[model samples]
Target: MSLAPRTCPPVYTGSHLDTVPQGGKYDGALGITVPLAIANYWHQLGYRPVRPLCIIAFAEEEGTRFGKVCFGSQALTGKLKGLDPTALMTREGQNLPELLQASGLTGNPFTPHFPPGKCFLELHIEQGNALETAGFPLGIVSAIVGIRHFTLTFTGKANHAGTTSMDLRHDALAAASSFITHVYNSALASQRQYVATVGHIKVEPDANNVVPGKAEISLEIRSETDTLMDSVLAGFQEFLDHTAQKYGVAYEIAKLDQIPPLPMDASLKDLIAEEAQAQNIPYQVQPSWAGHDAMILGHELPTAMFFVPSKGGISHSPEEFTPSHDIGQAAQVLEKVLRRVSAE
Candidate 1:
């Protein structure tokens, strides 16, 4: 049978775990090693792909050093602009641009992105319990949740905690606490697959004697549906307004980042399902709560991700693990999908 060969160059065939200091071994390594295993199997069987496959190992996906996640992918796609290299200083007090120039790269690092034709697949350990709880060995990702992050500040008049009467105090910390409660309640009440969290909070004048006059919190909202996320944000804004008025505090919010939800390629997902069935591997289709480089590149190219079950659905920890059988099943399915794509 004549096959249409894929022509994409520099396929990202690498482990993508640069962030999450002391991350699980399989989080990034499996995605890299599985493809190599498949290639070795094909070679042993005297099978050759119609298209050239190149494996690349990238070390900068975590963006811990530059404060930019998916640094390599984003840079190559020209998604990063107006970057002041001199302003970006490392923890060692070194300018990032100067470091790049010293390394023999002296131009605008951002380049125009070209759609590298189809055939992008990422195999990862499911960071959630969906697969394991459902007793599925493998899973095809349906979509990646959209993410919105914000920094909120609540400001009020600081005063002596012991002298301030309960009714007379314009407590920013109290208002912030109410907001945090609302966030939890709303998330629980949301009918859709939505989650809102106030993970970080700081109280100003954090002293036993001083009433907090300023509070800052880090808020993050995630949902598979953009419309749902927008609705949640609207409701949250209203709550924030009400809280500020209740405690006589002034509130401000600064948006940090917003990434839209991404749906997987329908045809590719179907192919993955077929391959799983053909291999007698139990699989499911699920939404990914966490972000990945696959989703970043998936927006521009036809990309697919297969997941192996994580023990107790835990990931990004030193104890994170996936059983060998689950890994094998996922790898086999990925191998089949790659072969089929190559033959198409």
Candidate 2:
């Protein structure tokens, strides 16, 4: 549907529609479904808010298809005004520019625009068992965690695996392995509740008879505080220095991205909390471990998130599940929040 105003809407309820490969049913879709349900409820009741209510089903949030997280939100925000669609391709080898052209977006450019004035609220699965484990149906998101990404590369001399002596030969993959171990242990010891992952890795000449000459791993760290993420990053750098020396290898660190933690609007968060209590739904205020479109839009609007418990702290997989009751409860809080914000 076309926007009624060129300017920002006073109220917005949206979530992404895309999912990762083999992704669960609830991850991005639940957020959109809940808001749409609320809009439909208001329509059935012939009720109207003080201002316009916009329901947006944003696309490509997972970025799994093209490796661009928050694609839809970024475009709506005008961040993609000059994006070169031809430079990106889907996993299935589909050309982005061609796809857009086919969808009738050839000459026209995309402008950033999910513009919200008074508030934006997103309801999503907790993606963790926090609420479920705590016996609460819903959660009030106080903040979204900050994220830092880096690429760590290790370089060493290639040698025949059979001819290389254990102490004399330098192995890039070995050094990479040590760094990964260090990351895991350090995260476990974090007092700031940090999570560090070396999820992607590759080694050159991946042969059983050849020593790896180079290894690269993608490193990501997340926490509620930027300072904490920095602290960990610094420590990792130091450890890498020692690792390079110890393994007789050289290392390089290339920084990729950093997303600062975003605190939800105080009043919006409080409103959700208050409404939860009023509705007799138990709630916990917590920080989101995973990223969300809410975090991106939070920078543009007074935003907040409501989370329903995932059955087993699972998400982004077919196993992800949230009870129907939990979803209904979270939706109720979002509806109440919208009503309160609209009146203000």
Candidate 3:
């Protein structure tokens, strides 16, 4: 019912976690605590459910240490195929196979197998401004957005800034800048659910007196529908090719990771909505822009997710917060839904 609990949970700090060095109070912790609270309430009331309930606190959803997100869920579902235990090194100079053996798990860590489930549900905080913007306290997730990470490199001649003629020079940084602009305009002009971000960029050369020779860009694109994602990516590819040719530079794009959009079960969504209505809670049906373990489980079993409002739509930081009343409301709604489902 509960996993590891923090000692001094993260609170409102003016600075980011990197500067302040604090943990978030609700990023991934709330999903576990809220369910435990619900179970405690039923125990206090001496009420027994018609069906059994199991709560799991997945080991590593954030991958903050290993640089591999969804480690627990991926291990459970056998998605860790081809993962070499010897190749994965930790901060403590530990490898995965050694770590597993130390913990008494004898087989390869990548070979873990989990049983099929009847139903799965995850309660989480809305990591975006959707619920707050919509003026709702709760939301039932309709789908989890598909994700794609792109690594792009633009190569051009590195020359002296003072001596190189503007007309004759091929500037890789300028070409990259053009593509960044296109990524913004195109995604903004597309469907409301489509989003694209150029998160990281690097320019080569000692820059004060040199024309940039190479540029590296890390681009991430997400969409609620796969078709829309494909369309936007195609547009981006065309623009990249055109920009490279026009600027007299060469470019390469490599897809680092791609996870397709996953839809929540229709029946489970309806059930949550009904429970929210019955409890007189304000709710909306929306899609999750961020990833979660529910997306991994939904691949095979019936899974549902309900979300509570996040303050200022901020998360993954020290400032992330959810009001106490909002948290209680979400938990009550969750309990109502689980009780209803147990009866069925």
Please give the distance, in angstroms, between residue 17's alpha carbon in candidate 1 and its true position after superposition: 5.3
**Model 3 pairs whose backbones collide:** none
Candidate order by lDDT, highest to lowest?
Answer: 2, 1, 3
Write model 3 residue lDDT over 1-344, tens digit each, in one string.
Answer: 21213222111000011111265688767877776787889889887665555666676677765667777777777988778768877778888788778888787767756555457788888888889988999989999999999999999989999999998788999899999999998888875669999999999984878999999999999999889888888888899889998888999999898999999999989988888888899899899998888888888678888889999998877899999999888888788877766554
TM-score of 3: 0.87
TM-score of 2: 0.90
- Give the runs in model 1 whose Cα sits over 4 Å from its true position: 1-19, 81-89, 94-115
What lDDT score belongs to each candidate, Candidate 1 first?
Answer: 0.80, 0.84, 0.79
lDDT (Cα) of model 1? 0.80
Instruction: TM-score winner between 1 and 3, please give it.
Output: 1
* Model 1 weakest 10-residue run by lDDT: 1-10
State the displacement of the C-alpha of residue 101, model 2, in Å, after optimal TM-score superposition.
4.6
